[model samples]
Target: EQKAVLVTGCSSGIGLRLAVLLAQDAKKRYHVTATMRDLRKKDKLEQAAGDALNKTLSIQRLDVCSDESVAECLNNMKDRRVDVLVNNAGVGQIGPIESLSMQDMQKVFETNFFGAVRMIKAVLPDMKKRKSGHIVTMSSVMGLQGIVFNDVYAASKFAMEGFCESLAVQLLKFNVNVSLIEPGPVNTEFEMKLMEEVGKSQFPGADAETVRYFKEVYLPASHEIFTTLGQSPDTVAKATMQVIGMRLPRLRYQTNALYTPLVALKYADESGSLSVRTFYNLLFNFGPLFHLSMNLIKCITCNCFRRGAVSPS
Candidate 1:
């Protein structure tokens, strides 16, 4: 049977790739409802879906931030039967928290935290009543451990992680599986958006020293980290697919092996200063040595060329 799979934020990035992958599954395992905020943005997704556009994949309009939109989306579905719900819709925020606007910070929470909450609320009733379903959330490495300037954004994900952790236990009794896909940097337009934000945004309230550090130091180092550790959206999509296929999908799946150590540092110490100090050293003192260490991590991760974990296989 082809499971009814509904994936949000399918206009681009990981969502689009995952929708296409499931719809084009060799075994015809999924009937995909690929949704975005507006129908006007459907062209890229439609073009990519090709022959599967209607046959296995259908596009819908869904704005996760609105209650009416969420209700309408679920109402539009046939019998509202969604066998798998992939919460992939999210927005990014960067720069110093001090300079960030109130509306901007709220928008991050609205879209990233509450957005996923809204979707899960819409689907959980049916999933629980039916006693079966898979709920997958596209989380981030920041969710595991907060990052330097990503305070607000990381808090949003941290909220999600907490929400899911608490819900997963109850859902298990209902035979509903919950999983979080935590990927490190990915080579997506997400990075482009961040770079654009940097170019256009003026950190008005931030001190001059902090602004200089963000622009002159953090930006370069961030780019280097992304270049070194970023995975492709397709890679992440495949990881989602694998997680979905698991007989018992884990509560958290970290997609990039190179990032494993970064997250590991947090748990390596109970005082919690280990990860914080490590990030400070990496960001403030970033240089070729950082690059060399990154490359060394990439090399050491491979156990004779065949090592894996939270793998996108």
Candidate 2:
């Protein structure tokens, strides 16, 4: 039986491209199951595979947020064993903490954290039976270090990182590999969708001043970073295929320009002196520098009492 890989969120961006690229690999050693929340949106994914592709990619329906949907999708694939599973379905949100609600945080977790867990639960039985598998969680650079206005989204990635870490230890006995893709910012509808979701998740009960601040200071600054720094999904897609194929894949993969420097800083922080780089990282991440001003603005405007706001999924 040919080995198969299962990837979620294949309707667009990285998930879609990864499926297509893996399907077109010259060796054509693996079968690919490209799953999305809806089959109707698969035309572009189909196009990406191209008419002359040597590999096979079958589209399937998988809404990670729904247990029934996940179970149903898994049941349908009973005959086909999955060797690699990529949990790539995620949403992003940004806003003033006061204007964001608990519901917003829960919703983000529902899709990004809990949803991934649900999918794993659905597939683990089969993998356990075979004593082998590879699980890929699409995390972000934000997963390692906090940044401005990406509270909800970053938290979700952070949650996944921790989960994947513990899962790696537990699955070692079974030779089930767990890896995280911590790409910086990939150019995709993800950014735009984050903006839109944050806007919609605003609290109606928030004071007028709070609302005004979110409109003026918070969202724009947050959106600007994503708009400018993100890379093409194709870059990550190709890298991801390589990640799955490796016999001894690293626990985490960072595919961005600043990753090397950031990794260096990780050692710096661990060593001794709070160097300029460490200081700047602290200032930007949690200290009273850029985000401090934004938070102050939000506190005054949105009546926000917290530093981080959550977004609805």
**TM-score for each candidate, following the candidate numbering:** 0.97, 0.80
Q: After superposition, how far is residue 17 of candidate 1 from its true place, in Å?
A: 0.2
Which 10-residue window of candidate 1 scores lowest in summed lDDT?
301-310
Give lDDT: candidate 1, residue 301.
66
What are the lDDT figures for the candidates, one per model? 0.90, 0.75
RMSD of each: 1.5, 8.9
Candidate 2 lDDT over residue span 1-313, tens digit each: 4568889999999999898887877777678888999889988888888852434788889999998887777777747578999999988877666667889878989999999999888888888889999999898887876555567877888999999999999898898999998786678998777666765675666787766656765555554434544568988887788888789877888765433343345555764344445534534454335455434433453443221211111
User: What lDDT does model 1 reach?
Assistant: 0.90
lDDT of 1 by residue, 69-184 (tens): 98888888889999999999999988998899899999999999999999999999999999999999999999989988889999999999999999999999999999999998
Backbone clashes for every candidate come to: 0, 3
Clashing pairs in 2: 209-301, 210-301, 210-302
Please give the TM-score that candidate 1 achieves against the real structure.
0.97
Clashes in candidate 1: how many? 0
Q: Deviation in angstroms for 78 in model 2? A: 5.1
Question: Residue 59's C-alpha lDDT in candidate 2?
Answer: 80
